[model samples]
Target: MADIDLDNMTLDELKKLQKSVNKAVDGYQDKQRKEALAAADAAAREKGFTLSELTGGQVKKTKAVSPPKYRHPENPEQTWTGRGRQPDWMKDALENGQSKEEFLIV
Candidate 1:
């Protein structure tokens, strides 16, 4: 590979280079994942069991979405399921002496 003088590159040239690098990285990662999956599948077949049978068929478990329990006072579109960390709006409201019940969806 030829040495590239990144310090001397114009903004457009740098941006183009960055785009190319990102594309190349994505392609490399995809190829690696495919190769790994193929190897796992082959190994499973050799063992007389499919990969999905040993791994519960899911690459990742999906969490069931909880229904929103709280809504923003000013914006009905903004809501929280009353799980995880409190959102900034909820925090600010609580700091200003607003109770959690005030934001209840019901």
Candidate 2:
């Protein structure tokens, strides 16, 4: 709150003032963040769920990927789960007049 003339300050004084300002700002932000988190946790608890569950803040557990359902006709080693993008071999097969039903595992 002190109105000191910054122009009259030495280089070291200005640097010290900058550090103090930065430290104060960091401390203020940390306090605010903590308060916000506490409020969120309280609100979540009131709604019968933890803050992590309410806001999805917890690390998600990955589900096991399903086994491949379809296989290549030419090469039995090549297979697909029919989930994501098609493989190059599958694309080539399709291009060469091969029906997708021909590659079914069952």
Candidate 3:
């Protein structure tokens, strides 16, 4: 491979380079996810249940409601998937002598 002289590269060449880099990064992320899933499946087998048997449609049927949208910390005008949202009430409770990990089943 020849040296990529960025100063001499055209706009099209720069776009191609950017696309290639994004593709390589996405490939790495996909490989990591595949390895993690394989490990989970193997662990399930060691526990005397195959991945399919352990799942058995049980994992897919959650009845939880969708969480509310949250204002982004960096950009207040923007919103996020509340998977990482810390509501003000929850934060206050934790600050005032409460533990977030203390959920009780009815």
Candidate 4:
């Protein structure tokens, strides 16, 4: 590319140059983005999934909620999934000389 003598250019010429430069930059960035997306799609396809699925761009199918495994002894309304941290009610029961096994729904 030839050297652009901005010092010798008129105000109108400089404005045109700026516009052309901005357009070229935008086009280059758009091309790169498209190429990246294509690569990601190809990789996802190789893994038996789509780019949308990997990126969560499509509506996600939610998993079914698991049934409660443990129920509160005193309050039958309270229940625990038995996956994460113990519930406050169960903790209180244990602290008050109650066994966790006693609260088992079985």
Per-candidate clashes come to 0, 0, 0, 0
Q: Listing every candidate in turn, what is its Cα RMSD in Å to the true structure after a full C-alpha superposition?
A: 6.1, 12.9, 11.2, 15.7
lDDT of 4 by residue, 1-106 (tens): 8988899999999999999999999999989988887897898999999978887887344599978888987689899988899999988888999987888887
Model 2 gets an lDDT of: 0.87
Better of 3 and 4 by TM-score: 4
Q: Model 3 over residues 1-106: C-alpha lDDT tens digits?
A: 7787999989999999999989999999989978987898899989998777777845333387764454434445553334676766556656889765432111
Residue 20 shift from truth in candidate 2, angstroms? 0.4
Residue 14 lDDT in model 2?
Answer: 99
Candidate 4: TM-score? 0.53
In model 2, which runs have C-alpha deviations exceeding 4 angstroms?
58-106
Model 2: per-residue Cα lDDT at residue 84: 94
Q: Considering every candidate listed, which one attains the maximal TM-score?
A: 1
Residue 57, candidate 2: alpha-carbon lDDT: 72
lDDT tens readout by residue for model 1, 37-98: 88988999999998889899865535799999999989999999999999999999999999
Q: Provide the overall lDDT of each model, using Cα atoms, as 2-decimal numbers.
A: 0.93, 0.87, 0.68, 0.87
How far residue 24's Cα lies from its native spot in candidate 2, in Å, is 0.3
lDDT of 4 at 74: 69
Residue 41 lDDT in candidate 4: 84
> Can you give the TM-score per candidate against the true fold?
0.54, 0.53, 0.43, 0.53
